[model samples]
Target: MRFSISSDRLKEALSKVSAVVPSKTTLPILQDILFELKGNALYLTATDLEISVRMTIEPVDGEEDGAGAIPEDKLTSVVKALPEGLLLKFESLDSNRVLITTNKGGEYKMSIEPADSFPAIPESIGETAGFGVVISGGVLKEIIENTVFATSKEELRPATMGVLFQFKGDEFIAVATDGYRLVKIARRGVVNLKGGADFSGVIVPAKTLQIIAKSIEDEETCEIMINEKHIQFSTERITIISRLIDEKYPNYESVIPYENNKELVVERDLFLSTVKRVSIFANSTTNQIKFKLDPSGFVEVSAEDVDFGGSAKERLDCAYNSEPMEIAFNAKFITDILGHIDSEKVLFKFGSPTRAAIVQPYEDSEDREMLMLVMPMRLNA
Candidate 1:
């Protein structure tokens, strides 16, 4: 392949596609990026078996139409180190090699592999085969950020390693949990279906959601296509395809408690800060901290490290009229849940010390709702 593109443009495209390229693979070919030049547009593709990314760069000076694979690390390093405004030319040479030359009179040659050796890229699901949905990039990004962190990192529960995307009529819900904590966010009328089609749900890998979240622009719209086994996300110039988690997700709805009448409203910043400060004295192994709530509108946050003989306690005023109760929880988990809440105040509902506690923002918009659940830890006798 032969083409000329500005160094800055090429660098930007490479940064996006190279995210999926495997750094160390048994198959060396997977480390290279496939480059295809046609007319005045260039296509770059990279995959790591589970996920694939393809991006298109147009308006390049295409001298010839061909395809080749170049080492992703080498190409990216060269482009990034070169001057931003310099035009970089790529040309294939004899003996399976490619030459890269810059307008500043710098040249570099790297071994290239024929495009045929690369794995077959997944084709887009056509209109007749599967359903497609369009969502605002900002909305999608927010949904992913709000839930992806709660996904399980353990391999035993494959389903929990990804976020669940449930579609019910026009309501879109994203859920993630790691057994100890769960995040569920629902948005109404956010998913614009291309046709009159509905599906139950799909488990999307957390890595895929994270990549899409970083790639999409707030002003742009993202097109999503789903089939039985795979899912695809596409924007104007970039496309990403990932294999769906085949395991069935646990019924998360059953775990959410609706009968928790005990409610405590506290300043998010104050509670979060107190928890963090007290956590310093928490047992390193359990990271356990205790919350003693009083009907008098005050809550005590305390932690003790038995081994180190360290202890801390702080009292924060809150809005709670429930009977006095004490609950224990992992300080780290509480911090994570509180950090994601964007509101000034946070709401906590408790059924009992043994039952899971629900955390939410003090206010929710008409179109969106977010709920997070954190299981309570056992207190010392």
Candidate 2:
């Protein structure tokens, strides 16, 4: 089978689809992008069994239609290297090989797998009043950006490795925690069904959702459909389907305490900078930095590693009440969550020395989003 396609257009489309290819896979086909030509479009697809991406490119030039799978990265590189703005056409030499040529000059003959050898890709999702949510691209992107860092890299608790969505009537809540800290964000207009209300216990891997977040264009909103095992995201031209992490999310509810007494408020930028500076000298193993609150409303960020002749300390104006307190935390965790919070000042609360102090924007919280929680560190005993 043969097809003539525009060089620039083909490169742009193939580049998007090939990003899903696994760098190494036991099945060679999993390392390649499948190209299927039908009617007036070029269908480029790549998958790693668990995650799959299929992108379609509208056709061009004299073309005969066919399907084939070629080395994902190699094919992408060849198309990218073709002299800019040239037209590309490809034809299958046999069931297992293809020849690529361009109008302005450049050619490639590559071996590939039969289209039939490709693994099963997700099909168009069936409608069943499926669990759905819609939010602006900007909102979704920012929400994940702010919370994904809180997800666990350790897969011991698979649920902690993904973001959880809890639908509560007219609103929805998103929570993420890595056993170190937790972040909760809320969005409005979550449809809650009646009669025990349909709920989706879907946890999306932070990394996969990130890719889908990036693919969303400048559109106002996108639709999300959740099945028991898979979730589908659709934009105007782009569609992303991912297998949901099927694990029980921890009772995040239990981890969040109902009462905490001590509180400290500091300018967000000032606190972020001071923490960043003090972190430079933290222990390599723990990356622990200490915070000292004074009765006079001052917070000092400090860290020291005697082995490396490293130490740093900075102070910032803040709000403090009750007994003065000192706490330590993983510097990286502090900086990561701080970077996502968008407020002028942040509130830090402490229940006691052993508990993590909750960090949150100290502004007029017009809505009810939960506070970001961080577990305290153990200082020298």
Candidate 3:
């Protein structure tokens, strides 16, 4: 088959789905993108077995319909380097070679493989009808941004390596935890698809959500479908199908402390900067940073590395209403929580230095809520 499309447009579509293609796969064909020309549209698909993304783009000019697998790196490199707005010609030649020619007389050829070599996109399990939910892209992006950072990288506990999506009534919560830090984002008044209200929970890999977040545009709404094993996200330009983590997420709510009576409100930027600066001197092994909350609205932050004879300290004014207290925390953990807060000010609720502390945005929104919990470290001093 032969087809012609804009180089820039083709590059953009390929980039969107290319993240699913593993750089090095046991099956060499997995490194190539499956391309097919059907009717007036050109379809592109990429997969790593566990996750697949397919995109359809209509060609500006075309001839016969055809399908083949083109080396992803070759196609992406040539298209991206070509001058924008140039029409690119793709034609299948003898001996499984595909010729890519530019409008300016530039030509390139690469070997292709049968499109059938690509694995088929998975379908929902038999006897199980799928359920779906309709949510705005912006809202979905917010949920991922708030929680994905806390997902565990450990492979042994596969559940903790993904973000948990739990649906209850009209609200849905997204939770992620790496054992040391937990992030939960709750959104209310979401529209549930037909037969979707009864759906309980699903764990989505953090990598999948990260790709979805990058592909979606603001103000766009996407349809999310979940079955027993596979979850799908469909938007205007692309559709992503990924296997669910297939593991039960921990009962994260139980771990949150209820007796965080002490509250300290501090400027988010100031606190974040202080933690980052002080962390440079923290022991590389423990990353321990000390926080001394004063009743006079000042917080003393200090860190020391006995091994390297390095030390750092800073004091910042804060709004503290609770009793005087001192807490020790991993400096990296403190900065991570502070970085995710969008508000100008953040509130920290603490019951004791040994208990998990909750961090929240000082300003509350009606439709959404975000809470982060960080486990403290033991002070060396």
Put down candidate 3 lDDT per residue, 227-344, tens digits, no spaces: 8888888877778888899898899989998678788999999999999999999999899999999989899999999999999999999988888888999988898889889999
Candidate 1 global TM-score: 0.96
TM-score of each: 0.96, 0.90, 0.96
lDDT against the true structure, per candidate, is: 0.90, 0.77, 0.87
Stronger candidate by lDDT (1 vs 2): 1
* Cα distance off (Å), candidate 2, residue 336: 0.8
lDDT of 3 at 113: 92
Off by over 4 Å in 1: 127-129, 194-196
At residue 52, what lDDT does model 1 achieve? 92
Instruction: lDDT for model 1, please.
Output: 0.90
Q: Given candidate 3, what's the lDDT at residue 171?
A: 82
Off by over 4 Å in 2: 4-8, 59-62, 82-84, 190-200, 364-370
lDDT of 2 by residue, 1-381 (tens): 677777777776775666667888788789988877877777777788877777766645436777778887778877776677777778888877788877765678999888888887765553643677666677677667777878988967888989997665556678899998999887665434343354645799886777766666655466677777888776655567788898888888798765887888889888888888888888899899988889797888899987888888988887898688888889998998788788898888789878877888887356546469989889744
Question: Once model 2 is optimally superposed onto the true structure by TM-score, how far is the C-alpha of residue 73 displaced, in angstroms?
Answer: 1.5
